[model samples]
Target: MRKKTNSAIRRWMYAMAYTAVSAVVLAGCGNGGNEPAAGDGKLTVTATTGMIADAAAEVGGEHAEVTGLMGSGVDPHLYKASQGDIKKLDNADIIFYNGLHLEGKMAEMFEKMEDKKPTVAVARDLPESALRTDPSGAHDPHIWFDVENWISATEVIRDTFIEKDPANEGDYRAQADAYIAELKKLDDYAAEQIASIPEASRVLVTAHDAFGYFGDAYGIKVMGLQGISTASEYGSKDVSALRDFLVQNQIKAVFVESSVPKKSIEAVIEGASKMGHEVAIGGELFSDALGKAGTSEGTYIGMVKHNVDTIVSALK
Candidate 1:
C-alpha cells in the first residue's frame, strides 16, 4: 500500500505556492541581471534530473558547469523545490528539465523561470507520435528509458548551449555528436541484450510504470503495480493483480527501483508465494534517478547499461 497521500499532496501544494511567490520576488530582485557572457568562464546550468545533468555535462564538456537538483534515489514526481533549489534556478544561466509533467509540482516554477533565462524542457518537444500516453491521455515523462529518445534530448541540450554560448558552438557540436554516437551504441546494446532473454521470460515487472518506454524499445512486456508517476497510489488489489499476472506468466523475477520503496514489490512477491509461485527480486534498476556519483551507474549511459544488464541477467 502507498503511504502519506494527503501529506504529500499538501507538501506539493505548499511547494508550488512557495515556488510561484519566490519566482515573482526573485524576478524583481534583478536575478537575471548577471547573465554570463560568452567565453566569460563556464556556463552555469541547472537541471532537474541527473539524466539531464549528465547530458548537459557531456554535451557541454568543459565549457559548462552543471548541477542536478535531484540526485541519486530521488523521485522527481513528488519532488518539491527547496529554498536552496529556488536560488539555484534563479541564478542559473540556463535550466533543463525532463518536462511532460514528470516534475509535476515544479511546473509553475519552470514556467516562471522561462522569461528570466533559457529554461528548456528537453522532452517536451519530442514528436507526439513517438510518445506513449496513459489511459487518461497524459504523455509518459520517462523518455530517458528509450536511448533513441534520449539521443534527441541530448541534441536539444546541445542546441540550447550553442544558442546561448555561440563562442563555443564548435565544441558543443563535437561533444554532442560524440555523445549521441555513444547513445546509439547503448541503444544497440540494450536491444541485443534483451533479445538474448528467452521469449517466455521477456517480461519486466517493476514498482511503477517507469519502464514502458524500455519495454517498447526492446520488445519486452512490462507490468507495474503503480501508475506512471510515483505520486500515484496503489492498493492491495493492484498487488494481487500483479501477483496473478506473474504467476500466470511464470515470470522469474520482478525488479525494484532505486528511488521507489521495495515493500510494494515485496507485497506482490508475498502474494505470489502464498499461491505457490516462487519469484525472486531482480537487482535494483535506476529509475527516477541515477546511481551514486562517480559510480559506474552514475552517468546516463552507465545507468542504461546497468538496467539492461540487470534485466537480462534476471529474466534471460
Candidate 2:
C-alpha cells in the first residue's frame, strides 16, 4: 500500500469517525428511510471516478444524481479523500468506485462506509479470469480500458440501482441495455480500428500499464514505463529500458496519459532521440480519468473512441 502523508492520514481518520457517527444518527432517526434524501427525489450517487460516475448516471437515468469525486487528469491511485468527499459519501444513497485498489489511498475509508450505506466497488465482482495480474499477482484496476469489462461494470451498476430503488427497476434495466448496446458498438469500433494498424506496429506503449485489457481485447502489445498502479514509481533505469525497447521495436509513437506527468514519457522520447530513433508523443490518452466535462472526450464512450481514434491515427 502507498504510504499516506500525516495530514492525509489525519483527514482519513476524521472522515471515518465522522461517517460512523453520522451512520448511527441516520439509523436512529424515526423516519422510515432508505429513500432518496435529495429534495429532487433522485438517488444521490457518489462515484470515485468519472467513468463510474458516467455509468451510474446512464443506468440511474432521471432517478439518480451522480457526482464524481475525481475529475479529468486526476490520478485516483494517489488520490486521498477530503472532508467534503466524506460528506458526499455519507449523504449518498449509493457509493460506487472501481475496486482492486485503484483508489489505493481511499480503500479503507470505502470499506468503513459500507456499514453506513451501499458502498460498492463496481469492478469488484468481475471474474478473476478476466483481470490482468501484475508482477505481485494483483489485479489491475483499470478495467475501463476494455469496453466489455466496462459493460459488465455498467450492469453491476444497473443491478445495484434496481436493488436499492426497486421502483426504478424497469428504467434502470432499459437504460442499461441501451448504454450497453452503445458499448458493444464501441468494442466493435475499437477492434476494427486497432486491426487496421500493421501487426508489426500494433504495439501500444503508454506512461503506465493501464491498457493491458485494451491490448488483450484488441490484439495489441502493450508496454508501460510505470507499473499497473501509478503509485508505483519508475526510475531512470525504467526510462532507459523503455527507450531501448522503443528503439529496437522501431516504434514511432508512444502515448502519454492525462492523469500522469508528461516528464516520464518526455524522458523516454529524449533518450530515444539521443539513440538516433525518434519517438513522437502520439496523444494524451484518458487512462484513469476522462476529459473535461462538455467535451466529446468527457463521456465514457467519447473517451474510448478518442483513445482508439488517436491510436489508429498515430500508428496506422
Candidate 3:
C-alpha cells in the first residue's frame, strides 16, 4: 500500500463548483471488517479525512489503527459520508475530525451520531483566541496549514487517544512528544524560508479560503476568490472585485487549488488583463490534500513545507 509520494493517480475531478484529487481505494470494507492485524487489535479509529488519519496514526503509534473515510484531496468542507463510510462510523470506537465546520457535509451526520461513538473534534480544543475566525461561527478548519497551530491540536489528539486507550498511555505520549518535536522543526523551517520572500510579495491568493491559519501565522495575506468553503458559489461581482484587487495591488501571481476548480481564477486573471494588469498562475498548492503517500509533501510536515517553499519561491 505504501508508495513514493508525488502526484496521485486519482482522476482530476473538475466539477462546476469544485475540483479534487480522490485516488485512495480503501481495501478493507468500512464495516466489512475482515480481521485486525496480528497484534495491533484494530482499534477502529475513524477520521473525517486522510490528513487527520495520518496524524492520528503518527500520534497513536502502534497502540491503535486508524481509518480515514475521505480519501486524499477530497475537500472535508464538502464531504458527505457514503453508505460504506456510515458503516465505518457505526463500527468505530472513537472518531476524530477537524471541527470549525470543516466537515460541512458531515457536520450534521457527526452531530446526529455523536452518542454512538466517542468523537473528538481536534480543532475544538484550541483556545478561541488561537483559532482563525470567519463570518460564520465556525473558524477555519485547516489548522494543519500552520505547524504551531497543528502542534496544539496534536497535543489534544494525543490526550484523546490516551483517554480512549489507557493501556498505551506511555506509548501515545512518546509518539506525541516525537511528533510535536518534528512539528516544531517544521515551524522553524517554514519561518526561515518565508523570511526569504520580501514582505510586500508575501501575499497568497488561492481559489478558496483555506489558508487562514497560514496567513495568521506567517504574516502573509491570504485572499480567496471564493468564500471559506466551496459550497458557496462565486458570482460575477466577486470575480470582478478580485480582478480589481489584483490590478490595484499589481499582484504577480494567483494560485489554483488542487481541489477547487480553476475557472473562477481564470476569470479573475482575464478581468485583470482587460484592466491592463499582469497575473500568472503559481504552482499548484496542496490546499486540501497532501502530495502522494511517501514523498516529503505526502506527509503532513512535507505538505506544509511544500506549501511554504512554493509560496516563498513564487512570491519572492
Model 2 ranges off by over 4 Å: 1-34
Candidate 1 residue lDDT tens string, 131-239: 9999999999999999999999999998899888888899999999999999999999999999999888899999999999999999999999999999999998999
Taking every candidate in turn, the Cα RMSD to the unseen true structure, in Å, is 5.0, 4.6, 9.4
Best by lDDT: 1
Sorted on TM-score, highest at the top, how do the candidates line up?
1, 2, 3
Question: Clash pairs of candidate 1?
Answer: none
lDDT by residue (191-223, candidate 3, tens digit) is 788878888888899998888888877788899
Worst 10 residues of 1 by lDDT: 29-38
Any runs in candidate 1 off by more than 4 Å, and if so which?
A: 1-21, 24-40
lDDT by residue (tens digit), candidate 2, 23-100? 654463221245655588898889999999998999999999999999999999999877678677767888899999
Best-to-worst ranking by lDDT: 1, 2, 3
Worst 10 residues of 3 by lDDT: 16-25
TM-scores for all predictions: 0.91, 0.91, 0.84
Global CA lDDT computed for model 3:
0.76
